[model samples]
Target chain A: MTYFHSVKLHEDKCKGCTNCIKRCPTEAIRVRGGRAVIDDARCVDCGECIRVCPNRAKSVVTDSRALLKDRKFNACLVAPSFFGQFRSEVSLGRILASIKSLGFSHVLEVSRAADVVASALSKHLLGPNVRYPALSTSCPAVVRLVQVRFPDLIDHFVPFDAPMEIAAYAARQEIKLATGCSDDEIGVFFTTPCPAKVTAVHQPVGQGHSQLTGALSMAEVYADAFKFLPKVTHEEPVYGSARGLAWAVSGGEGTAIAKDDYLAVDGLQHVIALLEEVELGRLRSVKYIEGQACIGGCVGGVLAVGNPFIARLRIARMSQRLVSASLPALDLAPSALTLRQTLLPRPFLQLDANIEVALQKLNELEALVGQLPMLDCGACGAPHCRALAEDIVRGTASSTDCVFVLRKQVSSLAGELMDLAGKLPPAMGRG
Target chain B: MVEQAVLEVAYQVVGGDFSQAGDGASRLKRVLQQIGLAPALSRRIAVAAYEAELNIVIHAYSGVLKAKVSPVKVEVWAEDQGPGIPDVELAMKEGYSTAPDHVRALGFGAGMGLPNMRRNADELEIKTVLGEGTIVYMCFANRA
Candidate 1:
């Protein structure tokens, strides 16, 4: 029952203007005591709050450079989105070399793992028991969202380790055999674009534990990579296929798998809509769904630098340059890429622990909703009237907390006072 | 331990409004989920409700989809004023749709509606008046 969240609210910086609460896909946030509070059970760590918070109060929890310096042997597992942040002209080799200069012993590209995932996914799709419109499990936020909001569709999720997890395993194995270090001695760090990856590493959904030691934000590593790009002399061996590198942007997985009826949706809201269609059984014709939490895939991550469109363009140019090249032999064992454990649904919004109690609450909620004006105005510090009713049932709020309801009560009391004055007070004053 | 309480909610379905066809079922699904029903049970109810909703939209003039929830079972009653099916047995058969070609072009009326609903619901009862309308009742057991 341990909870690990990558996004944290900085108390001093939070203005509690209800921006994050309104934008949060899961309604996991509440503005209480003039500051935003995140419900750990409901947060999926999509970093949407980090993106929408005007005061920059929302920030990611990541491993610092000091932690990297302490490791005996450090290996950086680079997300393909990392390449999109740099100039299009920069070679992948130069980017790899630049990452090495940031105090790392080895640099591994997650795209290579993505290639393995693409292969595994194709094989899974060809199986007789494959679920129709199987959802991609690569995006941790998407997986968590499904667990919370679309529990019945959990079986539709393709059971496989994400490219980051696979890359961390491969990177650790390579670094271990080369340096003859113990597992604890080699720190495998992932350069992540979103906070969900950080949460994934710390509290993995389908695995016993993450192979990665920690995650470093792409934004945090960008400046160092840029400063050292020209200084590196040694050329790092290329490991990623063109199709694999394409995983950094939206539609890349569907395209790489060569599925004609696959759907690729980006942005948290769009993904939610697509999942809703899937829930309604309207997407029966689709073979697979690739959902990314960010608008333009990993390139549009909250922690990523530059505009998403520009980053996507750069990634596309990079893909075009490498598409014609032959793929290298994979260095890791293919069997290691499969997920070791099953992911269970996380029903974050369950009405109550007891079903009978929940039904009673539902009745109470219905009664309360009937009494309130259905104006979804966020005047009560809750997102909507329905939400306020739920809060009232939970004993976290009262009906009078609503400004409209309070105004009605005040006006009615004033009318009663006026009527009494007309009847008795006027006679006493005249006499 | 006390007598189970049944909570009922009614939705008005407009005919030929493709955009709003699934709204009733979707809302019902959310309610079931929030009521702490098992996912499998909730899904079955949702699928049955959706198919029934779609049937009214495609063939009926207008309809009312009502969902009743209790501790023992979840029930959906869909009644519509439309040209009733001459043969309920034929209507229940897969790929036996009588929808116009235009409806077929919209990717619906492959005639899987009633069959799919039957497949998901534990109990189904249909009542229709030849020239007037049809009423379909679906029930799902709320087993722990």
Candidate 2:
């Protein structure tokens, strides 16, 4: 069985829409016995199911409190979008304090890492032979999609680590230096609003494993932050430009890639369609493309609280209120930028990157897909289209993998009940 | 005469359109899936068959991707009327590709096509004559 570090589907909460079953890239989930079941084998743990489920059934298996209970030095790198979830009166510092009260020794704003990524991206984007424009590597889901679906555009992906990865690396480095602890002794957790980050921890891009100890969801942190807001003291705000702050939006990466060139696409289906155009060479001259699998970028993540619109407003307001005009200049800090770039894992899309097992699985999948009905009805608790195609190919599922087949069986049974009930009562019939 | 195949797709390649060469192969892959071929084998066959078809589309003046499905494997034939490979041995190398700059931009012309086709298909056969057209026959074993 393939090991899935994330992509947990709660059975009791699932309404059996099978939406997740269809949306999963690896055909990881199957609907069986009136519930969606996650197959460990086929699942790459991409978390597409968590994003599409309206009933809030699909969830990630995050790091437990046990992992943090007795930890010596634990640091939390909070996402900026968390600021927009609650009322505006509660400042972000209070939220950080709330998390700090819950056993965290220190809390660092991830926005600082965003500052570093900006400088790195600018330098890389200005490189030679980068004619096709650079694509942002921020969204792990979008990056994975490119690896599997659009390998042709692999070079177009900006050769840089995302803000989250950079922040995790920086946070770890800082904690060790400040606390005088070994690298392994310092635990670093990312306050994420999505499950993709959780998957990224295990199967990181450019690197086989992540430096992050774990991920804490934004929704999971909201209650504690709200209750602790009154007790904590607020810290001075960190500074970043409006454009950098705008990374919370759908096309924010594109804006950063090039003001006059490039395009940004949001939402999973929309991004998939645009990728087809890119693969077909229709957008050849375009310099950069920012593809976010989520609707409003990170703010609209499934694990986030409230609507993305509110989050956008909060981000905008926060950006405008920044006290500093320019970023603090780097004072020849030993070229941390170069070291940071090397720290990132190379793109895992290389043909040398484990095509042997993938090839074997592909053979098995091809055989199974042939036997399926090709309906892609999304009845199997999976979304329709090719995902179901991949599901059946893997031995974890079968042809009845579609839930519609079972629904039809149940409906026919219901029809029999209605017909039988239409007859008169026994006494009346006898009379 | 019984027109043997219910579906037949053909394309004409203008010299340097190597990047767009995979379009036809991808369409063929979808069609194979639509006709209810198992996905695992379809994926394997799709890769090899796509590589073969891409070779013809990119290098040849014109080519055809023809397929027919039965209870078992789907039989595919890619016939190209372009300048044929002079040496079948050297052409089969894993890194051998004749694609040009414009093609490279589109991610093709990587000399991995012939080898990839052999890897994906259950059975593959290629017949070529220098200065004449070439024909490739491939089969993706139907596990359905």
Clashes of 2: 28
lDDT tens digits, residue span A99-165, model 2: 7777787777766666666666666767787746567788887776665555445667766667777
Report the lDDT tens digits of candidate 1 across residue range A140-192. 99999998899999999887889999989888888878888889888899999
TM-scores for every candidate against the unseen true structure: 0.96, 0.64
Candidate 1: the clashing residue pairs are none
Query: Which candidate has the highest lDDT of all?
Result: 1
List DockQ for all candidates. 0.68, 0.06
Best by DockQ: 1
Over 4 Å off, model 2: A12-16, A25-27, A39-48, A51-56, A87-95, A129-133, A240-243, A325-431, B1-26, B29-144
- In the order shown, the chain A TM-scores of the predictions are 0.95, 0.76
